[model samples]
Target: MERELKLTVATERWNSAEEWKELKGYAKTFMLLMLLSMTFVILIGIGSYMRHEISAKQTTYGLATVDIKQSALQGMLAEELPYYASNQKLDTFSLSSLGLWLLEKVTNVSLLDPASLVASEMLYSSVEEQSTLIHGGEGSDPAIAPQDDKNMSLAPIDDEYLDELLAEVGNDNSSEPDEVPVAPEQEEEPAQPQGVESAAKPVAFIYHTHNRESWNSETSNDDAQSTKNNITLVGQRLAEELEKHGLGAMVSDTDYPTAVPDYEWEYSYKYSRKTVKEAIASNDELQYVFDLHRDSQARKYTTAEINGESYAQVYFIIGQRNPNWKENEAFALKIHEKLEEQYPGLSRGIWGKNANSGNAEYNQTLSSQSVLIEVGGIDNTLEESYRTAKALADVIAQIHQSEG
Candidate 1:
């Protein structure tokens, strides 16, 4: 009986020990899980604090003090975020742009649209002070205080002088001391004069999808948009100038904002596609299509000095969404090469755009010869743009004539 009692006691002891072991294991697991949860919460708090601090400082100091000197980063940002790239030299830095850039960097996602962001309005109240300079208002004082954009518009030039300037530009040998720098051969034989009649049916079409896009000097209100003095005028000028080169050209006047029943700016290319189709159907002779736009960059990047005159530079945009985009790029390269030879520093290299960046196709599939050209920036004046139009006409004419 004593032996039986001892065995029962031993069994009870073993059972107690086993229960203790299981309890210890549970404690260890709970401790590990609690530790992990605490670490995660701490990390999240730190990240939120850092983001808040950085944003606060950026708001107060305008990121200008950051002095981002990395060219590769700048180029990449410019390529990806068009607004941040374009407003590099603004008097007041844009807050939304800075936030978007940081967000994109941290998230590793592309942010291409800038129109949706609330941006600081850049003002050019001291344009008169800038006009006195030689480089078409580039290098203007950044110290000018930002003001409300009310009644800001391009100062009118003397009409007689403008006519004389156009005439000199058209003349083969007319003595203008600062004539457009041309290739050695072109200097001997100037471009065909500006009013030559072309009997062939209109083979080139020039149109503006963003017809209301206006320069700082072109608008008279808070927004840089206008009904009359806008990009359409540039398209019109290009068409008339192309006609002077014996290439019949037509310009579109379809104002999408009013013409479309429910117009959305994002669907601008859709409206323009309809216009291009109609033009093609009506005129089978159309061989080339040109879409003209003004860049949103600063004056320093968009203005070029040639022969003591400031000419608004050109940027060729080829739509990568088109299956035959390479063909259009090749055609653009031909024009770009001619511009480089004739008007050095006028072409700002060719860039390709896709849906992530913009309307990917840009209606380029319509024709291999189709191209989109950015003539200048917001700060460029009408006269500077006109000179660029004339130069483009000269180069395009030479190319067309050679092909024939």
Candidate 2:
């Protein structure tokens, strides 16, 4: 039979084709898997790059110069950009900064920063803060002055008015849900007790230069200014919280505009300076002095969420005009670092300003331990601000304990 059989070359190869078919299938599968893997890696890279770009744009650091012409560049550089380089440095120039500058000019919407845009002339103004922000929450301009200065009235806050406000703060507002508002999805949790009680003389003094600064939520007004509800209430809350931490804190509720004769908003520092001097003179034991203020920015720039609770964000301002501002900055840095550890994003960051822009000294020359604190903004709620006050007291107590 073998001798009689005749097979063509094609038939002979077909008899052993199983092996070749299997190899071809394997090769195709391997190539497909390789392509899929490469595709996955490319997608991941694109996503990562996009995330990093957005973060870089929003980041306060880096070599980004501000767009300062009628925009809030000066305010932002003064408020957020601590590591910003000199304007003369060509190497540090940022195209992003330039783009932001151009965008701000063309749109007038403050695409770059959300600071005090409405009141550039005043540095920080009550009326300017009430204006609607470009993005509903972001504007970096320092603040714009009202068109008619003659018609502007000083916030009608006096010592008598402050006393009335203080009297109400002690009363338990049972109708209010809580001192700290929670996120909608979060359930109300019992607040942890703050600090050990102690009978100690006051070492900290909390005062407000812009005592009439009020929150939109508290005042229910556009101006966010009132003789009834003001930043002095927040200072009072801080003093109470500090007391709970076993740190004696004295609060000043002096309405500067009313306290000083022929009061001018520009002379607010001068008025507050007298207050600080008198307090220091009265008590040499005072080591820490905090000038509490409300920022002119919108809610988004001044709010933070910790766990399920909402809190007003804080910023520490150092006056470069003071020869010893570095020492004060160091002290502020300690508190800031502690906050970053315990509660992240609670502090926006430390900012420095000299005489060229705003209140250059901010009374930092009075004491190396002195620092200006801007809590919340015109749009924050009293509950949010109180939460921040408690948070600040918690950290300050820790520092005090550590130092002691």
Candidate 3:
């Protein structure tokens, strides 16, 4: 019986070992399948992510290219488009065609108005008349005497009075007789009217601060030098124009002994004030003073072509910081009106009445006729600015002659 029990135990052990091996094989297959499934999902996710990234990059590039193209188109429109259109005596082929083209091209830019541009040009043509009416009544000087039409009369002198005068002249001539004394022919010299001297007030004085040390503070040394050269050339031109109109003008540099800031905003008021005070101390028959400066606007120079020559745009800046602001503004308005009359669109406009913010005095307190004129930006060449100055001087000369 013991032998039989041992055989049964051995058979049971062999069956148990076979069942364990089968379970191990099934577990291994399940794990292998799970690993393969996970690998497939990871590969799909990576592919989807790469595709999405590439699409996003392409969209950004496309938008950037569109922006660049639009910018180029706008630049071409501003710079090149206007030259192709005719300005004088606009017709269907010129005005209408150009207007339609511009309208179509700029339709997407809703801010621009075609009518406004045309209106501005028309209004600019009538600036002189508008300015005169705006300032006061009548277009001529009011100080002259009125014509006397109703006081015309004719009176005859007495013949007896003339004979008596002749008899007295004969007696006087006889009384002056000596031993063969011959009377010299008495010639009456013409009498000149009072207050009719040849000397007249100057039109304007060109003033500037040549601060070499502080030139590079905001603009470069080259810019400052260009400004100086332009001013000098303009001064010469102005002098010539004044001479042509029989007016005496002197262009002198304003020397400030103390070192100060180059920029108008950074300049010390006390220093400027002191310098101006000293300059006026030696004021030898100076009538008008012009402080010349350059504007800070764009990186590229701004230039205008007038009468086949290029010129820079000028801005008339009046300072309300002085006690004589009203008088200064009046003087500036006179010049402004005259400029618009002679040359259209030469002046930018009159600015600086509101002194509450960012108002620099610019030494206008020295005289009622003082004004600060900004010629052009740093990008403008010296020749362009000089041309503008010459044009300004001509306007001033015309005004001065009219005043005289």
Candidate 4:
């Protein structure tokens, strides 16, 4: 077993001296590439194993480390993104950087687009309208006449919407809560003898249902005002004009709306009704009660150019639900007819709305001579509304002069 034959055949076929010199360079380069490839594979495997281990540990122990790390990463991105965007040139490919760049572009585009501004305005107006519809605090009178989507003409009012506004009425109609009666329906009254007038006595009582309705003429051509400085001032001017025409007028500046615990529109008329009753009962000379209001329509709908002067268009609203609506209707027709004859385009035609359609009686049941007058629109300026009021005073005075 220890005997071994010694062989002496030496062979250099595998690596001859000349071949080794030439092959060494290629062999060295191949070995280096292989080493690098193996090292990369090994590192990838290690990383995968580490992730698995971390996931397993989290599953077993319910550790918050991953969540905390995610939060930290998001916070870091949020905090660093602006700095990187402002300071550094964002030429590198990164997901967070791309997102930030896109957001900035979108912001810039929104600022440049005029439609975006219009969209924002529409949104704001819609929000305001819905809020008023819900709260019953329509200081701008938007619900009084909504925009007509179809024809863009003067839109008829929604009565059901107006009916909901009655929530503002107080418990003054009856001592018992249930005793308040709906305005009773009666036969239309015959026209009374015309030309009934008393000398040197106030015959007209003018008041505002929405005294807070204002105009934004100082700021913009559009109507966006809602301060106390609007419609109430027009009423004052109208009262003055009435006196000049020999028609004594009592104008009320009562902010009865402030007494409302909430935006109670129903109570608005009821509260004003109390004021009306007190006026009529206290003064036997008061013959006509006018509930002056501002129309919420657009400028074109409420404005009229008459004899090179601008005036707000006027409308006479008749409540057919009241028992004495015929009397009110007759008087309103007379006024409307008279105005049409003199002022022409200043009149916007008469509108009749019943309880089935809007506020029903609209406190018209309280008196036979009650009339609801809408003067101008939201876009109408104080000067325009005042001019119409002056013209109105003239018309009423002429009617009064014709009285017996």
Candidate 5:
């Protein structure tokens, strides 16, 4: 198709300069309002962030209380879920952390990482599973389930004995002078402090699931703890002494605080299991693994007078929850025999506990050399505990040397 046309025309008569000027002024005012709003929003964000940081200053149990939550161990490989780690800390100045923190403040719910949430659900689920096994499983005895809530008693509650201990150790501090019980040795000068050449291959690994378990010597408060001076330091001392004696050793002072129930201790072993596995995985030479703990008994039951020196009594507790408990029992028996030979009466007989009474297997099914060693009690002094550690180190050194 084809067409052609041409025309000339002037501007419209409705265009007024005064109207244009008014519209331009309105645009500027609008821009100013927008700028003020932005500034107010920024100030609010900063204030919220500052408030959050101030409130979250206090320390937390494993994995901070980020409302969103999820929180391991084993021998048949390992459990499906990992133990809840309470050591996670939030970055104070991180933008993402700030925004999330604000969200948590605004909303009642928490926001946790996917993995952590999953792990937490799994851990609680496993607890329920263990409870079921202890209760209604085939071959489960009614005697084991006498108390409904006793399914996972962290510490043994022997009513009669515990009452006796409580009565003896009242809340107040002892009035008697705190003295260091000395060793007036009547035997060969406590086997000349033995030393071993430094080796790259680590032979032993020591850790405390409940590192806050303090003693009277360290904190002047038996049960109360100043994390600085607790059984954790004892474990480090043991590691240092062992390393000197040629048993190249490592010690972990990871504190697994009670993030759940106020006094529950069952989660401790699972926490230590993760630490031990990581340690052993990195160093294939780690053979001897110990989950050191302080007993909760009275002073008389925990202190041992041997060779004129005070040594905290050591007890071997084996868990029956795992299928490979026989291996753990065998090692405990061997140690018990050796201890008898070296320091008779110093070793308490092997105590077998299950989930029904105490933490079962205690991560023992992970390896043959795994053992839970309770050194001393809440009333025992740190000095006595250290002495026991030395004696135990000597026994382990002897065993390691024999193998070498």
Candidate 6:
């Protein structure tokens, strides 16, 4: 009986040991599954965070790229922005205004529509009129004779008229003595007077003359003087090139107010027109008038390069709001063509008549040959732009020669 009891206890102990082993194996399997689930959750969180970071970075990079590209393009083409921080005009006339206008007009995105913005501004400001004059005035022909013959016969003769007539006849006779009936003098036609080639009149420059003190005031004199010095240097170079090509050219400042920093955007048109009209009145020989200026985009200073040397790009701006826009565009095209030929890729491209919200007329209405040339942005050193100016003078000389 004792041996049987001992054997029974041993068998019970063996069964308990087998049950404990099975529980331990189940616990190990559960722990392994839990670790795998936690690892998967951790990996998912890390992946999601990386994806968000990448997306945010891409958005930031894209915006910066767009702004830089636009600015570089503007500099190359010579479009005007607002003046310095003191005189801000860009807010009133935004590029977005022009962009929205283009979005409304252009059906396809593929077309090169630089004037989309300008067209919108036109739609709002354009007015249709039957007369050519800006102000209403009676149109008449002074050259036409009156229908009444009686009125013509009733006119009285005056001593002043008779004296003028006799004087003119006497002068004519003296000048044509060889034609008188004295054997015709065998005058040899005076050798037909060899045709004389007149030297080309030098190209003239016009700038705002008023507010000279403000432009070169106590606070901003250095900045203003620097800009003027650069301009004078460029003018000198242009004059030299013109002389080299036998095109007589001169650069002078119009006695008008200099464009105030903040006033350039809104009041530029008025000031520009006043100056140009004055120029026309003073010198009818003024053929090409260039309003020189600098830009404000920061990136333009970095992107422009010429002959492996980084420099500021130049732009040609035109206004589509004026009646003389077609001629202005033609003049711009000529400048672009000439510049590109002389300095390949130096010019960005000719901007359309309407692009930005700033003044469209830009004093171009004063003359068909007038243009606004933006040398570089504020960030660019004055020296870099002067180099560009030298190249530009060469190009202008070539164009002048060709025209002659």
Highest TM-score model number: 2
Model 5, 1-404: lDDT tens digits are 12222221112223456678889999999999999999999988986665554333211111223453221012111222223222333222334654665554443224664432343233123322222111121112222221211223335533343334234333423232111122345132322111121355777878777678776556665254656787887787787778768778777776667432454454455556556656655555668878888776667666667789988877777766554556677777777777778886677656655544545556665567788888877777878888888888888888878778
Worst 10 residues of 3 by lDDT: 144-153
Candidate order by lDDT, decreasing, is: 1, 2, 4, 5, 3, 6
Which portions of model 5 show Cα errors greater than 4 Å? 1-199, 220-222, 258-266
Error of 6 at 186 (Å): 46
> For model 2, what is the alpha-carbon lDDT of residue 111?
50
Estimated TM-score per prediction? 0.53, 0.54, 0.43, 0.51, 0.50, 0.45
Number of colliding residue pairs in each model: 1, 16, 0, 12, 10, 19
Query: Residue 365's C-alpha lDDT in candidate 5?
Result: 55
Where in model 2 is the C-alpha error above 4 Å?
1-199
- Per-residue lDDT tens digits for candidate 2, residues 167-202, read 433333333211222334334442211212125778
> What tens digits encode model 4's per-residue C-alpha lDDT throughout 103-125?
33322113434454343233123
Write candidate 3's Cα lDDT for 265-335 as tens digits: 23333444444443343334556677666565442323455577666666677655444456777878888
Comparing candidate 1 with candidate 4, which one achieves the higher TM-score?
1
Query: Candidate 2: deviation at residue 258, Å?
Result: 1.7
Error of 6 at 243 (Å): 3.6
Which runs in model 4 stand beyond 4 Å of their true positions? Answer: 1-200, 218-225, 261-263
Q: How close is candidate 3 to the true structure, as a TM-score?
A: 0.43
Name the best candidate (by lDDT). Answer: 1
lDDT of 1 by residue, 1-404 (tens): 99999999999999999999999999999999999999999988986766554342122223323545465456556766879888774333355666656654433223674532222221112110011111112222222211112332232323343334335334333332111234455445533312222456888878888777778887776567788888778777887788887789878866789888988665677678667756665565778888888777778777899999999888777766565567778889888888888888898767655433345467776667899888888788888999999999999999998998
Full-model lDDT, candidate 1: 0.65
Greater lDDT among 4 and 5 belongs to: 4
Q: In candidate 3, how many Å is residue 244 off?
A: 3.9
- Backbone clashes in model 3: 0
As for lDDT, the candidate ahead, 1 or 4, is 1
